[model samples]
Target: MADVTPNVSLVATPEAVSFLQNCQLPVQLNAMTGNPAHYDYDAEINTAITNLQGKAKESATLVARLTQDEVRTSPLKHQEASKLAGRLVELAEGTQRLLTSKAKGYMDASSDFMGKTFTPNPQREGYYLRAADWISREAKNGEGNGYKAIREAVTEDPDFAVAIYNTSHRLLGLPKEHAMDFAEKAVKAFAPAALDYIEKSQRLDELAKRYPAFIAQVRSSYFSPFELAKVRTYVEMPS
Candidate 1:
């Protein structure tokens, strides 16, 4: 457990907020609005793969243009080529990571035309595979764990937490009884490390430890399509 994480205990919401504030992590109640559809994992992966393909083609063209002869002929071009080469190397690495044997299977199974949404196989889907797809299609090029990337993303933008819940609920269409099994598993599997990033709240960490199921419910209501839209407005309005 992090030194900052509270014990596996909580009081009422109001009390929890006060307790956290006393601990120096002030709890600010702010509202935001969002579109749930924006968080669908399948759609996110589809768009990423499409973009990767376009970049792969563009990289290949650049590679063709920056031939050895061209570099040898122009001293000025060598410096430009060096910078371009660095970028192409990054692109190549990302492409390689995304198209590995296992990742390629997911990519092949999940591809879609531009502007079309992709859907997961309901019966076959599991959070592990979803994490794998996320790692391949969306994690930073070198990041190995999709959930860690997801955790960072969620912490960076709480909206991502809503997306996880919404996608699991709507796109995957798992039974309500089991819909948030992933969140529960996340609580147990990742535990303290995961909570450390969530709003930097000892109270929330304790809440997750004590009531993982409730966390999903809270996120569901708090980030509902209607509520998320409001939050988006709040976020976008001028400071």
Candidate 2:
């Protein structure tokens, strides 16, 4: 844990406003920009993620309080409380964006020691292969087609999109979840592809039917010639 992280191990709602008052954006931003060679990349990234999650959770509690019927009846107080709650969420989101942008620097700097760490290797194209394999296995077992459920739920309950996404994010951090490992590798292998997927589609179900072709589509459309060449080299390398 970072020296600045709060010592409290929390449960239920964070009733205290100190966390909001103490949420320092500049400190969080600067923490991500340092050379990652000196730190454990996996630990540092997890810490950053946890911090963001904490802020969001705290903000959620405040949002709940603001949304309570009693608070809603008082217009000025309601507006002020809502504004403060929104600020906490905004702070968390800004920190997330800055950290993701800083990740390439950290990963690149820490590449030499990756063999000894749990951090995913960005240069490996086999990551896509792993994701393909995992998805295929999931399909066979009838566990991976939840994209339809996700889409339906997202459409029917847009207010819960963040909650659903957060559940997926938690699953990604689970210790034995190799799907996340593969996905992380694939993302670093071709982040633009992942971003494009996030921006353009929610149809993981349809794509899974022809996974290889889908992968190719993402690769060809989002990756540069040089990056494609590197991926091809990695693909053809003897494991």
Candidate 3:
């Protein structure tokens, strides 16, 4: 008989909270630089921002559902996590689009003259830096307690990776850099955490040899978009 895998959805459980507490999910104003690129920066950034906004809403919507209906509460404790995740996403995304545009280097004077300038709405790199700053304030303010928490395993999602990388750098209080060197380093540090989970995808092995660290990593991501908020917090925080 094919064994059924238990659903590993994101929930606002103590375990999940504990995991998130190990992370830093807030976006800060300094983590992004809206400098214009030779590429179609605005178009790319728009697509990226849209996606992040959706993610924010998705978490918020789920949390709303769980809270509005008490009947839906017992099987899972996703309430606290969902609410916080939604808030965090919203805060980070909002700051990127709204506040970061005003930062210096957000626009390219050369591109502007040529009508090829970046969109102040949400420049790719700029947005990240701004989002990181916003998140930092929230993180430092103990938003981690109220709307501060996480679990979505940081991965290669373009927008998310940018967020994680930016957040990691921001939490460390690094002056944001133009190159992706820092973000890449952040991703590399966490890549091993998701490797085991990827391996499991090839063959679902309930009793596969498990390393303690591997198990911890797998659990954070196995549930994915649904179980990620808690883990995101961990990645954003320092070691």
Candidate 4:
């Protein structure tokens, strides 16, 4: 007296079809135990679950590559991984929103790290501020805030050469007599860290020329690495 009817509507893809075929075998085996009439419906649901599992496995592979450190270090690889990571995070978030319980469990089981990366929160504020400061500095539109931010970054990380360079360069635009001492200090602080100290010294020389008195003071004051090298070169030159 069992109603045995296959539901055809549930078969959507090749994976789904394969899933339903395998699922039906189990239901057909246990037909005499319970719910013989709904075996077809159960088979369809299992088919959908199996198809979802296949898709989840594919996405998980991409997510794994994105969070890997070595992949993020290379410019080309990082760009590609970042895009894939963002997409996977978005997919996880959207799924979580539409199907809270099911998607939540799936995400918890499949990719907890992806879930955390996708969630928006204040932990990312520092990264946003750092990016904004860099953009403003490069655009040369918000010099005051940009310089201030760079200075703060230097305070937090003394070895930050880029921040030191920006701070010193911006300080050069201030009143010559007032900013000279700080600019000299910045140059000294940054000299060892810079890739091209000669170029930096040339730039500072141009700024120092605006105030002859400050130039004299810096020449007589304790010589910075660049200044000492310049002085030694002049001393050795044949006059």
> lDDT for model 4, on a 0 to 1 scale?
0.35
Instruction: Select the stronger candidate by lDDT from 1 and 4.
Output: 4
What does the lDDT read for residue 143 in candidate 4? 47
Cα error of candidate 2 at position 167, Å: 46
The lDDT of model 3 is 0.37
**Deviation of model 1 at 10, angstroms:** 63
lDDT of 2 at 49: 47
* Per-residue accuracy of model 4 over 87-201 as CA lDDT, tens digit each: 4334434332333343233334323432232233456555544643563454353447655654454434433333333333343343334234333344445332231333333
lDDT of 2 at 6: 29
Count of clashing pairs, candidate 2: 0
Alpha-carbon lDDT of model 1: 0.34
What TM-score quantifies how close candidate 2 is to the native fold?
0.26
The sequence of per-residue lDDT tens digits that candidate 1 reaches over residues 1-239 is 11111221111244432322322211221101112133234454334434533442353333234333333323332333344435544543443343243233433332321012223334545643554345334433433464456556533432333344335444433344433554444333433333332322332223224222322322321112332233334334577
RMSD of each: 27.6, 26.6, 25.2, 34.7
lDDT of every model, 2 decimals: 0.34, 0.36, 0.37, 0.35
What RMSD value applies to candidate 3? 25.2
Compared with the true structure, model 3 gives a TM-score of 0.23
Give the per-residue lDDT of model 3 (tens digit) for 1-239: 01111232243455543333233222311112121121133464444434444443354344434434445433233435444554554444443443233222233332232122112235577756655554454445442441222112223234444565535544734444522443444345444333333333222122112223323532442223443344444435568
Report model 4's TM-score to 2 decimal places: 0.18
